[model samples]
Target: MAKYKTLIFILEGSLLNEKVAEQNALRQTLKLTGREYGPTERIQYKSLQEKTKLLGFDERIKLTLQEFFKNDWISAKGAFDNQLQKQDQLNKDVLPFLDEVKNKVNLILLTKEKKDVASYRMQNTELINYFSAVYFKDDFACKFPNKKVLTTILQQQNLTPATCLVIGTNLVDEIQGAENANLDSLWLAPKKVKMPISPRPTLHLNKLSDLLFYLELS
Candidate 1:
């Protein structure tokens, strides 16, 4: 039998691929603002975005564009929309694993993306069918690495720490959040992804298909 009754999957980088930058948002911002910005300015803009993450991804991006680029709602909104559709590629290997374990495990989507964006991507990829429930970033006031979000989910599901597991691509905050919640976690780190020295999760897997072993699916 599988060890956990509930499996919570982080949606952004965990299932879908990373965002591919087609048009430079930075340049777009500068052009829209009619300002000259060099590498240093670009670096500063990105740093600010990372720092103000508590405001949420889309919100932060929108604010950054408004503050730096000024009065270009159309361009700023376009840049945001581009990112929503960027990582549409699926980890094909996960399909078969989901097929085998779908009936046995309670699937849940715990994502950092906004609800509308998450729904759009999952629906486009036809991945929404796998999850019984989805909790988005907007759903929680406190973000990941804070135990409150996971604690709330656990309470809602009436599930204990021992019976739940989080499978995510991030080794830093994701794993730390799971541990903080006292729940087991599985880190999905591909060879191409450079991981920092961080707290390890219950399992470190290179491929999503590796979950089949834990599922005991043949």
Candidate 2:
């Protein structure tokens, strides 16, 4: 057994680098409805990215086009779900890396991905059996910082927060979330990101498997 009993992973770029579920959802929704209000320029998208209120793909869709496209929301939302089903690329490293600790640790997958979309990704990537639990964006009342989701898991699983680790590819806000929940954090920043970084990670990794080296197995 490893020293830690639980490991919570943020799935976006950590478990899988592809965010096709997000971008594709937006693209597919746009294509289905012929809405061109979506910012095409990188600057515009980047500007919107910083707006926390418009952070969610579904929220962005509903709010931005709510006026003219109000009637077709169900279909537009369906398009988002449809594209998620076809999302390509699973981090090939995920299964092998997870295999190292699955038996000794309570493997939990946490994501901003909604429940259905997350399930679709897990099933399609053959990752359904690897996780003991999965957390969706809609699963919690609020996002990480405002919600101690990790702590919630710790209590539910009868685990200790000090013995848990939250791993993420982008820790800008997630580190704070983990800390607020009283859990340690491990981050993988392959390269420099243009955005300002905050709440430093407890550990940094060059590769996913490197996480195993830090774990104390018994």
Give a tens-digit lDDT track for model 2, residues 1-218: 33667788887767765454455655666766666535553355445445532133345546534433467766666676676566756666788887777788788888877877667666667666788887788867777665466767677778777788888755545767886776778876653433235566777675788888778865
Instruction: Put down candidate 1 lDDT per residue, 1-218, tens digits, no spaces.
Output: 44778899888667776422212445544655576668877677667745653343456556766666577665667764555454467666767777778878888889886787777777767678888888998999999889998999988978777878898866556788898888889888765544444566888788887777786432
Q: List the residue pairs that clash in candidate 2.
A: none
Q: Pairing residues by index, what is the TM-score of model 1?
A: 0.69
lDDT of each: 0.72, 0.67
By summed lDDT, which 10 consecutive residues of candidate 2 come out lowest? 52-61
lDDT of 2: 0.67
TM-score for candidate 2, residues paired by index: 0.68
